[model samples]
Target chain A: MKIEGVVFKAGEVPKTLFKIVSGTVRETRNKTYHDLGHGDYVALLEYLLEEPIQENIVATEETEIIEVSLEDEYLNIIKRIIELRKVIFESSIDLEDIVLDDFNFEKVDIDKYLEQVESLLTLSAGDLPDDRDEALRVIESLDDDKIITKVNLVRSFIEKFPEEEEGARLLIETAAKVYIVLNDRYVAKSLLKKLLLHYSDIPKFCYEAIKTLEGIYRDEGNIIWRRYNKIAKILEVKLRGND
Target chain B: METIEFEPGQEIIKEGEEAQYIYMLKSGKIKVQLGLYEFVISDNNPEVFGLEALVGEKYTETCTTVENSKLICCNSSEFMEIYGKTEVSKKALESFMRRTAKVLGWI
Candidate 1:
């Protein structure tokens, strides 16, 4: 392909996928420019999402690209990698060091993460409510000044009805805020983690937890935020899968 | 808020320019450049960019399209007035954090 030649232009309905072999292609979307080099798939996201190609994909030099198939094993791996990247991107987590060959989905330990989430779900909540109704009454009877008492009652409610997702959600959502007010971030962070992990299906809670965690980690410093940000991205993707 | 479309290689915002709007990716991809640092923002997730507008500062970064793109542009002051407490602010904060992380070579 000659320089400035269009491989695919924005607004074109994607029909085929191409894999870059050599040279470079520049993808220009609106005013942004990104170079796609060897091994990068062209129109892959658009094709996969069934959306019109949204970028002007042009050869930036004498580029060689080969048409690829969805069934090709290597191409499938690429697809999976791109899909994973898409998930992380959607979750607002960018892994800048993702070398394709070094990437392994199995190594992500999603199962282990899932296992931890499951363990949390089944862990004994210190004491079960005498009954659901009693837990409800206590949960409903909160005074604005008694932050500690509110935390305890919230914790008790969760312990009392770990299985009650809807009821538990209401209290769990507010629990983190209260914990923050009490300056018990360790507990608050853990509670938010569990809340997000257990309630991955609920988008609102995931957003809240991620946002809160982002704030806490940001306050902690760049290095800590860097580490937690990756975990947050993973958690976000896990939640995306649930969605 | 209004949706705006751009062609490939179009400058959405320029460094040292007046920052009029905070932009969110409605669709497509954008390349952001700050000094020697650069990164791409795509619609894989709805991301708020051009955050300098939120602080009433001149744009410190340049944003351009790497492809045809659609963005939700909100007048900075208006956005602050209406969406200060909304998820948009959270997304903006997250974007700011990510940029800081990039500056620190942590992203």
Candidate 2:
């Protein structure tokens, strides 16, 4: 059967091995995570070691995975792969100077630390509500640059309080910045539409959303025109004369 | 291809509509209903639906808005043709089917 999947996310390490009968594999690794997609096999080392596995394997998109067991034949393949992997990892490591040093434990700065804690509490207590209000105020203020900062602040606040309507609104405004940034049009369009539905009465949000919708259509390439037109019709109805 | 926006409680694609397009959720949340089962796919987990239609098949379920939503629509035939040409797309489709089958205990 055919398979379709994307590397939605990765865990600390890979825990599965997939032998590609056919197709290609793409592996992406970033500071926070590592992703493996399609034809890549996972966990060859663990299978060879017969050790407890420590990584996660999740399909990036809808995927077809044939689970391979550690049978004798598969074990031989795993052994070869493990040796190759060891060689690769070892060759990549660089030797560095090591200094032998004695460890000393320092006395804790109890009072100073307490004072710092109090200072942090005071700062957060004062700044949180102010930041939240400023985020809302900036949305109302409609200054484009302020709107962007408000969006970031709103997202930060939402990370702490996802149910906040004000924060959600700020996210919508931030989403609109897609038109200005030219990155991830789909995400921007989605955010604008969400704002109109959730914050329809917010005044000017609907207008801004419609304007962004138009921008999406104008900017989309011809190959995507058919999809753009359908979205445009909806925006036309939603924005009406607001745009 | 067309785009559709739905408010919470709105139905974007009915259960039995001739699946003509592949849907990409650009934002918000959508709920897919199949008989008694329901799952919500949102911006954080945007979904591509009506893919079966790409194989010239009927839609397996109805997709509606769980919250306000934005959807990008692409002609099923066009999308299938484009997707068919890509090795990644084929692998993704196969992986998805196998996983789904495993989850449902069908394989």
Candidate 3:
């Protein structure tokens, strides 16, 4: 493909998938431009979902692409990888430093860094009661910047301490609160809902989870108010002490 | 809050349709069709579908009855409120949805 040549125009039904072999392609979605070079591709999510291929793909330079088929054999492999992430996520088993992007698994230093993360989970909140900010600073600020690192660390903590309810609760609460600023709302919600039930017996845990839920509801226009109300009622009755 | 019965081949949901409920299969089997790309056998008790409704998105695939079946369906929010109450139930339901998302295409 040569410069300005359209590969896949926006709003077209994807009949075939394409992968870049060399040179560059420009992808414009919703007016945002992304440059794709060798080994770069476009619209896999839209294609896999069978939704309209709503992005314009044009060559930025002399480019070459091989048509990729969405055949069963190909789809099954994609399916297996998605299933693997879900299972790995649920287990909190660090796939070294794996994070999902472009269907690529980014492995990290598992044996060493994960051990540091695991030890961080065991730190006592009571040990730093006076310096909440200082203590949390030790666990990564969870600032909007570097949020991915925070999410992975929190996920590892949740996975590592399923049997240790306190450690898990702390990580879950962090996800619902700190991660709300990041792009992991749904993933955070999953952990929040799970922890809300798993540690509902502890008044403190219930309080934290409810606060997070309330914040999310507020941010999302409170459309799920009834659901929030119902959860609040159940937690209220189950709450042991200190409202 | 309602139990709907599906005579075999009845469509409970269609691909790209706006999602209204999250369904937990009460009995019998259902075929989850992913735009002719895949078909899933969801026969397990409490086999849940339309879970992407939780993300407030449209249906990702079609769900039709494969055998005479019953489904206990709840609005997305209501389903979350109820399922968010127990460890085992919440975990099992999440697991089921995660598996289904892979095979169900749009989810």
Candidate 4:
């Protein structure tokens, strides 16, 4: 006879070790018991413990069965599988805990790297007085990963030369983009307003601001639509005056 | 600064009244109803309503106390002043509006 499946309830006793000579067999906990196919074996743990089984075993489908008394080789295999399962379960829990902790950073020399970059930019400029071309080159050379980093650098450069309108405008545009990337819509809106205040004649900046406002409205309609409506009203008033 | 208590079925904020204050629930339950939609809150979940009206909307979802409830109310003018200055508050408002528009198919 062949064993097909095994089942066990919490408090019930188990006996009789059955080997699957053919087909599939399944052994599941009573609470989650469903069905098992053919060639399934059961009772290795019960035989090892030399105690009554704590679950009911049944054939899920048409099957045959043979009961084998306790044996040594079968007990070793079951013990090995249980030990491996325990390690796998514990490692999975440890991995999840580690991921939740957010503990992944490798220290590197950011200051040194910045110094090297600044030196490269200075050397590339030769004897030319720091002009817009040089400033543009420096801005272009900056890594575009985080808008904040680029904005901060440009801001520091602007602070050194307060009267540099071109540098200030460029920095403001970069900062606005950074705010957008960071999802800081209010800051982006405020920055755009400030940009317009300084350079109202720049149609490109106005168009950019309008586009940014459109995105902000799309992302956060309830918060941005009122502001959009106000801006739109102002734009309309200006257009009507031109006519 | 005073704690206002309301019994069950009391209207905390009507639909069309000028939104003069924002209420933060300190205890008990409240329900926010917009047309056929309703959401209930109890315990420590602080619900912010009447904010839509603060931006000159002239109306807000109706709020009613679902049980014996305590609330701390802040005047809307003062709240708006502080809220407008806050970057986080602005972002939150934007996110809320954007999601609402998407749901309503106006975006």
Highest-scoring model, TM-score: 1
Write one digit per residue (lDDT tens) for candidate 1, span A66-160: 87764453324333333333323333323554232211123434334433543554532234358787766665665545544444555566555
Top candidate when judged by DockQ against the true structure? 3
Q: What is the TM-score of chain A in candidate 3?
A: 0.36
Off by over 4 Å in 1: A1-133, A167-172, A226-243, B1-107
Q: What class would a CAPRI assessor give candidate 4's docking?
A: incorrect
Candidate 3 docking band? incorrect
Task: Write one digit per residue (lDDT tens) for candidate 2, span A1-243.
Answer: 345554223333334446544554343211112333444454433333333333343444455556664332332342333333232222221123211110011143322433353454442222334455664554455455343344434445655555566654565557766447647565465555555555555545555555555556445521122222333454456566666
Q: What is the lDDT, from 0 to 100, of the residue B60 in candidate 2?
A: 54
Name the candidate that leads on lDDT: 1
For every prediction, compared with the true complex, DockQ reads 0.01, 0.02, 0.03, 0.02
lDDT of 3 at A42: 48
Per-residue lDDT tens digits of candidate 2, residues B1-107?
77788799887777556767777788999877653336777788555766655545455557888888888788756665565445434333433333232222222
Instruction: Give me the runs in candidate 4 sitting further than 4 Å from their true place.
Output: A1-130, A157-190, A193-204, A236-243, B1-107
Deviation (Å) of A152 in candidate 2: 78
- TM-scores for all candidates: the values are 0.31, 0.29, 0.29, 0.29
Of candidate 4 chain B, the 10-residue stretch with the lowest lDDT total is B98-107
Interface RMSD of each: 15.4, 18.7, 14.0, 28.2
Off by over 4 Å in 2: A1-243, B85-107
